[model samples]
Target: MPHIHVRHYPRNFTEEQLRAIDEAVTAAVTSTFATGEDTVSISLEPVTPEDWDSQVLAEIAARRDELIKAPGYWNES
Candidate 1:
């Protein structure tokens, strides 16, 4: 399973806020999947917005049409 990783910019969130978010995520995932809390782990890594954008771009390039359909990929043109 892919790890749940969160990247936040500097000075964006407090430690308590981050912990709350992490716990909320853990609860949501564990509730839906019927898994142990240990199985649903979260990692908080701080990074700039540009880096996060780049990661999204790279992910799109890698998955492209297989995971994301273009305007008319499914329908006959």
Candidate 2:
């Protein structure tokens, strides 16, 4: 039940890059959760800098307690 979602700035990634990411994420998730490769899923979403505060920051703040690892950036505004 480990579904990974990555939100990042907009960019066009080639198929190789996408595949690499999926493989890397899958490996990490499997190692961390001791889960099988078949049970993991990954998705990436593009978030522009303009909407980072209202969208990403808000989400991080809202889910602070549940964050496995907090980011170095961001603060109350």
Against the hidden reference, what TM-scores do the models get? 0.58, 0.88
Q: Which runs in model 1 stand beyond 4 Å of their true positions?
A: 64-77
Model 2, backbone clash pairs (residues 3+ apart or across chains), number: 0
* Tens-digit lDDT string for candidate 1 (1-77): 42576555756678899789978998888888888888877877776767855764455566666653443323322
Q: For each candidate in the order shown, give its overall lDDT on alpha carbons.
A: 0.67, 0.92
Residues forming the 10-long window of minimal summed lDDT in candidate 2: 68-77
Residues 10-63 of candidate 2 have per-residue lDDT tens digits of 999999999999999999999999999999999999999999989998999998
Instruction: Indicate the worst ten consecutive residues by lDDT in candidate 1.
Output: 68-77
Choose the strongest candidate by TM-score. 2
Per-residue lDDT, model 1, residue 61, is 60
Instruction: Spell out the clash pairs found in candidate 1.
Output: none
